[model samples]
Target: MPAVTVEDLTVLPRLARPGLGDQPRPVWQVTNAPSGYEGEGFPVRRAFAGIDLSHLDPFIMMDQMGEVNYAPGEPKGTPWHPHRGFETVTYIIDGTFDHQDSHGGGGTITNGDTQWMTAGAGILHIEAPPEWLVQKGGLFHGIQLWVNLPRDAKLEAPRYQDLRSGTVALATTYDAGALVRVIAGSVDGHQGPGSTHTPMALVHATVEPGARLELPWEVEYNALGYVLNGSGTVGADDRPVRTGQATLFGPGDYLTYAADPVQDGRAVTLDVIIVGGRPIREPIAWAGPFVMNTKDEVLTAYEDYQRGRFGHIPV
Candidate 1:
């Protein structure tokens, strides 16, 4: 396969929508609001809502939330909830999240930690503030991604992987002043931690101003780059993107990204969530927090939750 370059990536401009004026107070409060994205009781807010990147595929939704001030001793966290027919990947950049599920799975995810939860069949889980985090007010940040499961794997057993920073592989492109942290899949010949059930790639990249980097296309999957901080340009041919937005690329095997030397003079951190899989173009019967192939399946999940079939706490 040919290596993709910065020039091959297309940039799709993201239309700016009216944002809540004056950055929401206590960012966490706004995100954790009862009626926000995800659903009620998912305490850690400050999430940037994202849509399905590809037309139909293994991935469904992605949310990046962070750069928020967290007060010490605050009882802020996600309550119990159930998920089916999908997986949840949580990457923590700041603070800590204590995760527990009914499958007898539990762990504390700190900065530079990754929690990959495969909610096959069914699972009930809760992420809450650790005692230490609650007492020590500081900055808390992270990203939560939702990946759809293939039909055959939908009813498989649930699994979880906790990866520390050192385990994940990193590929650096010095010429382009860019470095990519591979969370899954191969990047620049480097493989990442956390085994993926499906063929998918998730990378976190940082590019210095005026630098350029190219990504090869061997895996046919939908790709997108989300700007976390600073501004830059991405795309190929007629496509180009600006900062503070996500640029969805077109069909191709490779794509390139370049930072504007004049505007992005310094290094800019970009959180790129690249996901693609053989499209599962199946009907989606989603209800509040449960997503299944049919409405009956959704109902079954809820019924199980009510019956405490998933259990009250981690098994």
Candidate 2:
């Protein structure tokens, strides 16, 4: 939960209040994420399960990895794998992860760091806990989001971006009751450090008890909100939402979130991640690790990967 913090939020820039005639987004749907095990048995909540792909457009899926505290020798990670035709954005909130890819992109990202990998064309990669972390375990919590590239850019080139926590743009609500970390795209006039191939915005916000956060949003992008901790209400209509829940917002010029005045002992504030992107609207043929515009293209990716065209594991 400690991605980034500031003791004096009042010192940060404040987001402008919604102007007259600005339409507040209405709640379209609220879904409870189903928990399941992922890569080497780590727990995860599938954030986009049961949602239509049309609503998620340029974004494919998201996973909220463990808020679990692992004892020594209990932590686990993914095995080497290949991906094609998309990008993976992994943001670490409370732990460390090591990433290595065949394209020579590798790094260690700790709390509040991000690894953005574009598997444009195709690539082989692996993510795991550092050896030291595996021997002396600790808290691990993070998010992995899949962003789809346009059909034309899907095979351009592979690339990577390591965005440190310090680089994220920070802003607060007008009353300083919430802290907003802009990880990608622009929020109002505040821009995050992430360089995206698609038009999108990603934000992590912590709202104080009883505070309301109203954010202006892009009219062309579809908006979604996922709660990571505490209870809150989404939209101006106040539909109740809580941990492990995802909300889809309807058309509007702005979005609203309000934290309840009372929270359980374990949570002091409501933490949520909001994301939006312009719809690609192209046919998607997604198989294990490949997302393409057509089934034939996905088959080609499989064949290319099998032929070792995605590259080999580093010696």
Candidate 3:
């Protein structure tokens, strides 16, 4: 839960209150994420499950990796995999992960750090816990989001961005009741460090009990809010949402979410990840690991990958 925090939120730049002309985004739907295993059998919550692809345009899917405290020798991670036609954003909230790809893009990211990998054209990559972490397991929690690239940029060269926690932009509610960490894109003039082929914004916010967070958003981008922990109400109408839930919003100029006045001891505040992106609105042909614009393109990706066109895993 300690993705990033400020001892005194009041010291941070405050978000501007919604203007008179600002329109609040309406909550279109709320659905609970179903729990499952991923990678080498680590627990995960499929945050985008049951959500419509149209609403998630410009974005593919999201996985909430364990908020679990693993015992020694219980840690796990994903095996090598291939991806194309999109970007993978892995944000570590409370643990460490090692990332390496065949394209010479790799690093170790820990609490509050982010690894933005653009799998343009194609690439092979792997993610795993550090050896020490695997030996002496500790708390691990994070999010991995798949962002779709525009059709024109789908075959461009691959790129990677190692965005450190200190590089993230931070802000607070006007009343200093909530903390907002901008990981990518801009929020109320606070901009994140991660760059993307898509126009988007990614934010992690922690709202104190009874606190309300109102954020100005891009009118052109669609919006979604996923609760990482605790309970809250989304939208102006106060639609209830809780941990492991995702909220979809209709077109609007701003977004609103309020944490309940009471919370359990385990989670003293409500933690949420908010993301928005301009729609690509292109056809998507997805297979096990490849995401492409057509079935033929997907098949070609598989063929190219098998033929070692994506490059070899580092020795």
Candidate 4:
């Protein structure tokens, strides 16, 4: 991965269409899925990494954790690790995700659960399947997105927001063709539970065939739409997209998306995530696991971790 700085993508351009009121927000660009690689123990397809994009401001990286069926004892998850200057947002769709962090934060998330952790100053954590799930062998799938923190507040006290399944804000369309779960920010007046340092919206949308959703978004925020399952179209332009794809949109206060239900009365379900946030637009000095504003700060962070400055994980 190459080192990406604010200079590299500050001027992100968008493809314009007839209008936001009628046209599907123009699909500026479609992402190319990179091959899957096992990180330490977790099998993942890195959807996007800040280091690979022209604009990686509020977000640094996103991973689609294994959606594969794991036989008993087949899944090896990430062990204890340290982080600083960023937040990790994990959403579980199937099976269970168990985690233990040095901060004494321990929990298990099942279907529809989301855990948001801000490793401000620093923290040590482990993420793996629950022992029972690992033994039983079943479906394991989830998403983990790295949300970046502003430089000035990089060293603030760490915090965690654990939202159990069905606890996060949710909205269903009038036609019942679409369902949206809010992880952060608001949708159709429904608000999420996570307290964020930046102004943003992270939502998971599932749309049945022929169903539609229009989100009132701010034109100033950088917006991204990622397809998780099935096929769907976005904006007034009706730009189509399939699974394993993401679309970056230009300035628009509203975004519309729908699934193309074309089967024999069986709705072709479309699952996608839409996220928008104000870009920090500052220099990014990124090192493995640690993201700071400068190289000197990154080096200092490594030194602090080596010296046990962030505190210790209970054995």
lDDT of 2 by residue, 8-123 (tens): 99999999999998999988999999999988899999998878999998899999998899999998999999999999999999999998899888999988999999999999
lDDT, each prediction? 0.62, 0.94, 0.92, 0.75
What is the full ranking by lDDT, best candidate first? 2, 3, 4, 1
Candidates 1 and 3 compared by lDDT, better number: 3
Better of 1 and 2 by lDDT: 2
Ranking by TM-score: 2, 3, 4, 1
Clashing residue pairs in candidate 4 are 23-236, 23-237, 24-235, 24-236, 24-237, 25-235, 25-236
The alpha-carbon deviation from the true structure for residue 98 of candidate 2, after best TM-score superposition, in angstroms, is 0.3
- Clashing residue pairs, candidate 2? none
Worst 10 residues of 4 by lDDT: 1-10
**lDDT winner, 1 or 4:** 4
The better-scoring model by TM-score among 1 and 2 is 2
> What is the alpha-carbon lDDT for the whole of candidate 1?
0.62
Q: lDDT by residue for model 1 over 187-220, one digit each (tens)?
A: 5466778788777777766565677656654345
Candidate 2 lDDT for residue 55 = 94
Q: Which candidate is the best by lDDT?
A: 2
Candidate of highest TM-score: 2
